[model samples]
Target: MENNLKMKDMILTYIIIGIIALLGNWAGYHVSPIKALPGMLIIVLITIVGWGIKKILPINLPAVIYISLIALLITTKIFPGSEWIIKETGNVNFLALATPILAYAGLSFGKDLHEFKKLGWRIVVISFVVYTGTFVISTIMAELSFRFTGKF
Candidate 1:
C-alpha cells in the first residue's frame, strides 16, 4: 500500500503540471521560458519542503501554510538572492498562473452536477458575498497603503 501510494505518477503529475503552468505563464508574459525558471524552481522546491513539513508535524497543518511561510521568508531579508528572483518574476501576472487552475476547477465541478445542484442558490449568494467582501477589503487596504506611501 505504501509503495503504491508513493508511485511515480504522483511526482510526475506534479512535475508535468508545474512545467505546463510555467509555460503558460511565460506565454502570457511573452518572455523566454528561461526567465520563468526561477519562479518555477521556487514553487517546486517550496512545494516539496511544504509537503515534507506537512507529513512530519503532528498537527494537521496543510501544505499551503508551509509554502506561504517559505514565500514570506524569501520576500524578507532571510533568503539571499530573493529580491532579484522576486523582481524577475514580478511581471508574471498571477491571473495567468491561475487560468489553468481555474479551468481544472471548472472541469472538476462539472463531474458532479448532482452534488453541485444540492448546494442550490446558496452557493451563488455566498460566492457573491465573498467576492464583494474581498473587493471592498482589498480596495480599502490599497487605499491605506497608498496613503501611507504618499502616493494616494
Candidate 2:
C-alpha cells in the first residue's frame, strides 16, 4: 500500500509538471519573440518568487513553478534577437553557470561525504538510466517526427 501510494504520488507529480511545462512552453513561444527582455524578466521574477514561496509553502509547488520559469528562460534564449537581449541582461549566464556549483558546494558542506558514498552506486545507476532513457526517447521521437512530416 505504501509503495502504491508512492507510485501514485510520483505519477501525479509528473502529470502536474508536464501540464505546467506545456503551458509555459506555449506562453513563452508566443510571447518571447515579441517581448524578449520583458519575458525573461518575468521568468526570472517568477523563479525568485517561487523560490521564496518554497520556503513557506507545502508540497511541490516550488518545483513546478521553478520548472516553468526555467522553461520560459530557455524559450526566451531561443527567441530571435535573444543574443542582444541576453547581453543586455548583464551576466545572466554567469549566474546560471554558478548556480549548480553553489548548490554542489552547499550540499558538500552540509552533508557528510561518508553518507553520500553509501548511495553513490545507486546515484550512478539512476543517472545512467535517466540519461540513456532520455537520449533514446528523444532520438525515437525525432525520427518519428521527421519520418511523418518529411522534415528534420
Candidate 3:
C-alpha cells in the first residue's frame, strides 16, 4: 500500500483522463452525438463485467484482460446490432483510450523507485523489447488483414 492513492483521487484521475480521451476521439473521428454515449456505456459495462467475474470467480485476473474477453464476446455476429456498434465504437481510436492507462501505469511504476532501481536495467530492456514486439506484431497483423480485404 506504499503507493496507495485515495479512492476519490483515483476516480477523479480516471474521469479527467476519460474526458480528455473523449475529446481527442471526437476531434479525430467524426461521429454522431450519441456515438460517445455507446463508447462510455461499453467501457463501463466491460469494466463491470471484468470486476464481477473477478469477484465471483475468486480469480487473480486483471480487469483489462477480462475486458478484452468481454469485448470479444460482444463483437461477435451473434450479438444483435453488433455491426452498428462496431462501426461506431471502431471510430474511437483506442490509442486515445490507451493514453491515460499508460500514464497511470507509468506513475504506478514510478511509485516504487527503490524496487525499480533494484530491478536495474533488466526491466527496462524487457519492457522495451515487449513493447516493440507488440507494436511490430500488431502492425503486421493489421496490414495483413487490410491487404487481404483490399482495404489497404
Candidate 4:
C-alpha cells in the first residue's frame, strides 16, 4: 500500500537524520556516537509514533502537536521511567539535532522563494511587522523573567 511505502520512507529518513545528528553531536560537542545512540533511537521512535498518531487520529492536526505531547508526557514526573528517558535523551546535544533541521529549513525556504515572491508587498510588510513584534515581545518577556529570577 501507499501508506506502507510512506511509512517506510519516513522511517528511513528519520534514521538517516538521526545518524547525521549523532555524527554532528560527536564532531561538534565531543559526544561519542556510541553514547548518543540510545537517545537518538528514542527520539526517532518518538517521531515515528507521533506520525503514526497523526495518521490514526481522525482530527486534522499537525504531527508536531502529537510529537510534542508525547515528549512532554513521557518526560513529566508522573510518567513511569521518566528519569531514564530524561537521562538517555539528555545525552543528545540540542544543537546537534538543530543543525540538520535548520539546514533543511533553509533549503525549504530557498525552494519556496518563488511562491514567496508571488505574495504582494503588503504581505511582506505585514510579515516584517509580525516578526518584529514577536521578537520584541519575546525579548521583553525574557528580560522580565531574568529580572524576576535574578539571573542577570
Question: Which candidate comes out best when scored by lDDT?
Answer: 4
lDDT string for model 2 (1-152, tens) is 32233444544554444334334444544423233444345444544445555545666453556656654564496777656555544323333324444656897774676666777677979988999999999999999999999885
| Residue lDDT tens for model 1, 127-150 | 899999999999999999999999
Residue clash pairs of candidate 3? none
Residue 94, model 2, lDDT: 34
Which ranges of candidate 4 are over 4 A from the true structure?
1-5, 115-122, 138-152
Error of 4 at 62 (Å): 1.4
User: The CA-based lDDT of model 4 is what?
Assistant: 0.93
Q: How well is each residue in 1-152 modelled by candidate 4, as lDDT tens digits?
A: 32444888899999999999999999999999999999899999999999999889898888889999999999999999999999999999999999999999988887889999899999999999999999999999999999999999
Alpha-carbon lDDT of model 3: 0.71
**Where does candidate 3 stray beyond 4 Å?**
1-16, 27-34, 108-110, 117-152
After superposing candidate 2 on the true structure, give the runs of residues whose Cα lies further than 4 Å from its correct spot. 1-44, 52-60, 63-87, 94-113, 119-127
What are the lDDT scores of the predictions, listed in order?
A: 0.73, 0.53, 0.71, 0.93
lDDT (C-alpha) at residue 89 in model 2: 41
Badly placed stretches (over 4 Å) of model 1 are 1-10, 119-152
Give per-residue CA lDDT, model 3, range 1-152, as digits (tens). Answer: 31244545644655666677777676666544356766755665565666566556766666578778888888899998788778767756788688767877998986788776788687889999999999999999999999999996
Model 3, residue 53: distance off in Å is 2.0
